[model samples]
Target: MMRLWSIKRVLLAALMLALVQSAGAAKPAAAETLTIGLIPELNVFKQMERFRPLGAYLSRETGVEIRFTILSRYGNLVESFQRDGMDGAFFGSFTGALAIEQLGVVPLARPVNLDGESTYHGVIYARKDSGIRDFADMRDKKFAFVEKATTAGYVYPLAYLRENGVESLDNHFAEYFFAGSHDATIYAVLDGKADLGASKNSVFDWVRAADPRVDAEIEVLALSGNVPSNGLCVRPDLDPGIRERLKQVLLRLHESAEGRKVLERFNALRFIETSVADYAPVYAWAERAGIDLKHYDYENR
Candidate 1:
């Protein structure tokens, strides 16, 4: 009888402890992990290599475990942020605006380029032999854009065309194709498959360096006025203290020696503060282009 009682008592104790542990596990965590989502224009390995330094710097500075995440497409990044998997993101102006308007995110800062310019031009180019001289010449030519989500590719180019009285792809281009990324768009233009293409001037410069012949064959038919490039943003409900710290670290990145070195690695001049108000023109452009910026769905066409 005594032995049975002892075993029963031990079993009851174990069961009670397990119930208490389960209750404790149900509580929220003390510290939340910071998750960052990046674009996947380049190869996955190359993308990770480019942002690894920033990840390390963030970890060292904030004592937080910073993770570098990349989605197959910029659209996926925006979708994931909406689903609450991503805490912060670096996005093009269009996607950033969508994230803000769609997912309750907010623009935090933007990196100035090596020229100390926070903006870059959107260029529309055509093959040298295509006889496309300017925006008017793009009528009825087969065209390609970098990505639907890229401002340089879709937003700015479409806005420029609309402002110039070229309203829709069906009205202007013989057909339109999305090349999935700026690099791919350049390649399409260089191969003569696309009579016209739109992308950031910086991307064109990178392509020129890689292939001298592309520079010879490709000619810019039109260029949009300068606009801000990629922006770093955060979720709407991110803690104020953490948000302020991130902003401070980014804004001062070019001021300190270590931070400057990191910026050099990223080919950035410096970081500057910005707000949703800064992207007002982008929103207006979207409105003019008939894009419902708030209801952007990544999965569907």
Candidate 2:
């Protein structure tokens, strides 16, 4: 009886040791969360809804929590990146370049339109009844611009105007206002609050789709030269594993039905890899227009 009891004790101790080892092996690594910053492309509420699905999808695929942050001003977005407040971001072409230049953010991917193209145009628009027929007609009239940092909204349009002999808004337009968003700029023109407004072609299309009457209410006065579409970017110092996973998921977002839905919400057909070279024209245009990109005050109302 004593021998049998000794054997049982040995077996019980071995089993406990094995269980302890198993628990240690099965323990999960610490959870990580990645915060992504976004500039206001739509109204605050709609912009949140637009990116929520993508953030969830990224979190699920990367096994890390993903958070979406929206900034009211473009300068704030750049500042966030500089301060390590964002792990990644979606930025407009000019702003993306700025982030790259200022923060060393790595350009990752950009969305392709439904037509399978990645380039988009900026548009100067006026109400159909406003008698603003073209860029020249904008002279001596009040103008609306989305934001100074926006490539399509401010840079490209200003470049076009300057190229055509309008030296400065102060000298040409009666006055100008920064509407702070594409939708606001459009609304300003449609409501006769401004004689002309500038925004990206995609934003104009989205507004028209949401409110069909916009097509008849507003007319395109001029189109800026083609510019690279918005792109995803990551901090240069991001974890290699997380960065790889993010790149894979974004590049493949359109392959799965669930991912496709998210893309559609952003008016994107698919996401494709892009490089810094793709945005060279944006820099060129800014220089040509004499816009001081490095020191430009985006927060100035």
Total clashing residue pairs per candidate? 0, 0
Off by over 4 Å in 2: 1-29
Cα error of candidate 1 at position 256, Å: 3.0
Q: For model 2, give the 10-residue run with minimal summed lDDT.
A: 292-301
Root-mean-square deviation (CA) per prediction: 4.1, 6.9
Misplaced by over 4 Å in model 1 are 1-32, 41-43, 164-167, 297-301
What value does the lDDT take at residue 24 in candidate 1? 98
State in Å the error of residue 285, model 2.
1.3
lDDT of 2 by residue, 9-86 (tens): 999999999999999889986689988888888889988998888888889988989988899876678877767668
How well does each candidate superpose onto the true structure, as a TM-score? Answer: 0.83, 0.87
lDDT minimum window of 10 residues, candidate 1 = 292-301
In angstroms, give how far residue 242 of model 1 lies from its true place.
1.6
